[model samples]
Target chain A: MAKMNMLQAINSALAIAMEENENACVFGEDVGAFGGVFRATSGLQEKFGKDRVFNTPLVEQGILGFANGLAAQGTLAIPEIQFADYIFPAFDQIVNETAKFRFRSGNEFNVGNLVIRTPYGGGIHGGLYHSQSPEAYFAHTPGLKLVFPRNAYQAKGLLAASLESNDPVIFFEPKRLYRASVGDVPEGKYTIPLGKAEIVQQGTDITLLAWGAQVEMLEKAAEMASKDGISCEIIDLRTVAPWDVETVSQSVIKTGRLVVSQEAPLTGGFASEIAATIQDECFLHLESPIERVCGLDTPYPLAHEKEYMADHLKVYEAIKRSINY
Target chain B: MAKLLNVDNPNNTSKNDTLNLEFVDEHALAIPTFKMLDDNGELYKDAQASSMDKETAIRIYETMRFIRVFDERMLAAQRQGRVSFYMQCLGEEAAVTGSAAALEDKDMIFAQYREQAALAYRGFTLEQFMHQNFSNEKDFGKGRQMPIHYGSKGLNYSTISSPLGTQIPQAAGYAYGQKLKGDKACTICYFGEGAASEGDFHAGLNMAAVHSAPTLFFARNNGYAISTPASEQFKGDGIAVRAVGYGMKALRVDGVDVLAVYEAVKKAREFAVENNAPVLIESIAYRLAAHSSSDDPTGYREKEEEETFRANCPIERFRRYMLKQGWLDEAEDEAAKEKIKADVLSALKVAEKVAKPALEEIVTDVYEDVPLHLQKQYEQLKQHILKYPEAYPATASRIEETK
Candidate 1:
């Protein structure tokens, strides 16, 4: 094991992917000599040469369109959108083309070998355009697999797994943890299983569910809730699309109460999906109504950054409300 | 629009390096269409020779003949309620088949929905065509895509997607992959003048030029994009001169002349691979048939206009050219067309009779493996079908027998 941050972990995984597979290519806007804005792709062009690791013109739709073509031509293409907010430009290519290529062709051709990487979520002083969680939009697409990593170790493992899978994936990295979050990640190749949730801490009073950077906040909330004598089971949902329904359902059944949280808005956040699915599975368990702690429906405001966040304090309060009811 | 793939001002051909800014006249630039063959299949004076030989010429003509047969019979089938829908490459045949003939079989092809002749040129048989249009069990696409959305792995043709210009940028990426691998092959992207209005067209061409990737862009300027005319599509001198803004090579050719298209693409293919750059070719033709079986051109265009285009039919032009060259036998040509029509009808009858794909196909290929929720849903659907056998008679019996 070696000490690495989230960006380092991702860089290591990309190096391994290029080394192991001769057909794999990495390209996006400013991904060449400059690496990425977050340095997630640092030193890739130097190590792999400019041909395999390159920069594309500044067009999100073009990047995905090119990636789809490359992947269909039997290359493992990893194209990065500079930011999650900018990914909206390529929505058609991702939603209509990349998502449907395999199914439409009946496996004759697929962009299944492509993985799109983009940094998401808030905490940086990045105003409207940079700080937004758009996972909820892509989650609605059926053919795609959305994978988000919480920290250094998970980042390396989940990225490796995504590269190895035979389906197109959207790997949303939490930019907030790019450097702040550090851990001892394995030096060589390793993969975490897709669509499985990890139980960070087991408890009986309530279940705290979240993915990506929100998992870290849930852990902090669980710690705060422990002081109040209410034990919380914290489940980090690694893969968000075909999520670990069994794991979440089992936890909700044992705890008899659930609190879902996310960085997106309360109405249409992925938390609503979790709540609806879990309620169906654990309806017989005697508990209060499920609670969702999330950002407000309004656009993420600049001056109201702190108030806009559904951080640990809000999650802790939700836990207390669930336990008392 | 301040978007990535912004529309270019057609009149702004030259860079305004000087200080004063006066809007240039769009009419100042007149792009001459490169024509070699006339309506009588006779070459113009001082025209250059085509690189096509006698043998390859016959194969291309045959593919065009087959597509004409396929389009006619399929449209008839749709009228008879035997098929759901159909689209024809009717007047644009020579443009598609000629380019397909020019490329190496290994080069990947990304096409819009109407280039069925390209697939036929790449050896897509009559049976495969029938299976896809009929959406039967034998269809390689498994009835997922609509009719005319054909794809073939063995033939190296990208599956046809309905969304316009989506394949343009993809062709750039695929060609870049080939360039990196030191492969001599390149990728060709085909779209119509109507699709050029899509942002993807600008995005795709810009990327291909910027990266210096070897991609051939084939634009069939077939006079109309459904009811919308080329005049409404763009105000430029066709789609060819737009390549100049992107620092790429381009050609505007008479699309009805099969030999001219063959020669232009052959030269463009060399430039793309040799220089590792992009090239665009605009083939000027006319849409002889309605956009699809669903469209009726009576309201949009007059019969006189259709008659004008039909007078210089793509297949007839090529047939006349071959007869003039003494390369085709009159009796053999007549007999071959008769046999082709019979073969297409036989294949259509057999493909339609084939059963629909197994019910499980509804959910099988969405992912590598069906997830737990999907599996449960599939099981529940079976139970519901069994409980209401009368309502879903076809699938209920199949599920019962399979269980």
Candidate 2:
């Protein structure tokens, strides 16, 4: 095991993918010598050579379309959209082409060998363009898998898993925790399976459900809620689409109360999907209607960023309301 | 002013500094339509003679012949309600087969449908074709795609997608990967003039040129894209000139001339690999049949226009060329067509009788593994189907047997 930040762990995972599979390639804007905008791909070009790790022209749609083709050739094509916000330009390619490559062609052709990695969520003063949590948009796509990592350890394992899986994956890296979320990650390959949720801390009163950066917030909120003797069970739902419903529903059934949190807006957020499903699964057991602590229904704000956030304070308040009810 | 190109823009730069009213119309940038064979299947007076091997030439013609008969029979099957839908590459056989013959078998092909002949040229068997179009259990796609949306990993041909021009950028990326691997192979992306209008076309061509990717972007300017004509599709000089605009080598060729297409592609592949660059080739042709089975040509085009192109069918043009060179006999050629027609019919009969893909295949291959939600839903669906025996006739009996 080695002490590494989220960026280092992710970089390490990409290196392993390239070294393990000769067909694996990493390409995106400024990803070559510059090592990407966040330096998450730093030292990759030198280590892997410009062929496997290189820069592409600044066109998101082109990047994905090309990656889709490369994946069709059975190459492990890892294309990075610089930010999740800029992912919209390639949304048609992702949703229509990559998502449907396998199903539409039956099983003969697929972009299953493709993984799109992009930094998401807010904390830096990126205002609107860089801060939006776009997981909800991709979660709606059926043939795609969505995975996000909270810290360095997970960032390494989850990314390795996403790379190896014969399913198209969109890995949302939390830009906020690139340097902050440090941990001792194993040097080599390890995988946390897709569509499986991780239970951070077990409790009985209520379950705090979130993923990626939101999972970090839930942990802090759970800690504060413990002061009031509200034993909050925290879960990091690693996979968003085709989520770990069995684990989450089981937790909800036991706890009898749930609070889902996210960085996206309240309306039609992934939290809504969780709430609706959990209510049906554990309807008789639920003591109170599941509370949702999510961003306000607006574009991610610049000046009033804290107000727009569904931070620990907000999640703790929601936890309190659920327990009291 | 002198930073680049001795002035501002490559298009607007002039020697003298003066305000002038000028406009470059379509005529000013007139694109030369490449032609090799005349009405008698003889090379044009000024056309470059090709030193193509007899064996390669015969192989191209044979694949072209195979597709010609296969397309006609399949379209008839669609008319008879045997298959759900079918798209025929009836008139564009030479264009597809010649290009396929030009490339190494290992080179990747990203086809925008209608290039089934390319698959045939790369040794996709008649049984494989029947399996795919029949959507039987033997079909590699497992009855998932519509008929004719064929794919083969072994052949290096991408599975066909109905979406237009999406394969353009994919070829650019795949070719770049090949270039990086130091593989002498390149990628050939096929699309119609109609698909070239898609935004992916622009993005793909620009990216390929900028990144020095070795890709051959082949546009079959087949007179129509579904119901729309090439004239209505765009205002520019066909598709090849756009490659120049994107800073890549470009070519325009007669889609009916098999030898011309073969020679052009051979040189283009060389240029692409030697320089690690892309080349765009526009093959001008006419769709003798409707855009697809669903389309009606009488609604938009006249019989006179159809007759004009039908008179120049790619299969006939190539056969005549083969006969002129004494490479084929008229009697043997006619006999071969008869055998091909019978073989296709026999394959169709076999394909029609094969069982449909297993019901479980429906929920499979969408992901590497089905998650809990899908498993539950599938279980629920199975129970529902098993319960309602009479209503779900096709599936009930199978589920009952499994239970």
Model 1 docking category: incorrect
True contacts kept of each: 0.00, 0.00
User: What TM-score, over all chains together, does every model reach?
Assistant: 0.57, 0.57
lDDT (Cα, tens digit) per residue for candidate 1, span B166-271? 7999999999999999998899999988777667888899999989889999999988766556764567888888987798899888889998999999999999
lDDT of 2 by residue, B1-403 (tens): 4566534556653457658777656656667877777767788899888767889989988899999889999999989988857788978998999999999998999998899999999999999999988777888877656678889999999987655677999999999999999999999999998778767899899999999999999999998765456765677888988987888999888899888888889889999999999999999888888777756666557899989888988888877878899998899989999999999999999999887666566556657787665565457556655654564554567777888
Q: Native contacts recovered by candidate 2, as a share?
A: 0.00
Report, for all candidates in order, the number of backbone clashes.
0, 0
User: lDDT scores for all predictions?
Assistant: 0.85, 0.85
Model 1: what TM-score? Answer: 0.57
Off by over 4 Å in 2: A1-325, B1-21
lDDT by residue for model 1 over A1-325, one digit each (tens)? 9999999999999999999998789998657655766678889989988899876654577789999999999899999987897787689999999999999998898888999999999876443455789989988998999998999999999999999989999999999899999999999999998899999899989999999999988999899989989899999999999899999999988999999999987767789999899889999994999999887654553323444577787788788879889
Q: Each candidate's DockQ score against the native complex?
A: 0.01, 0.01
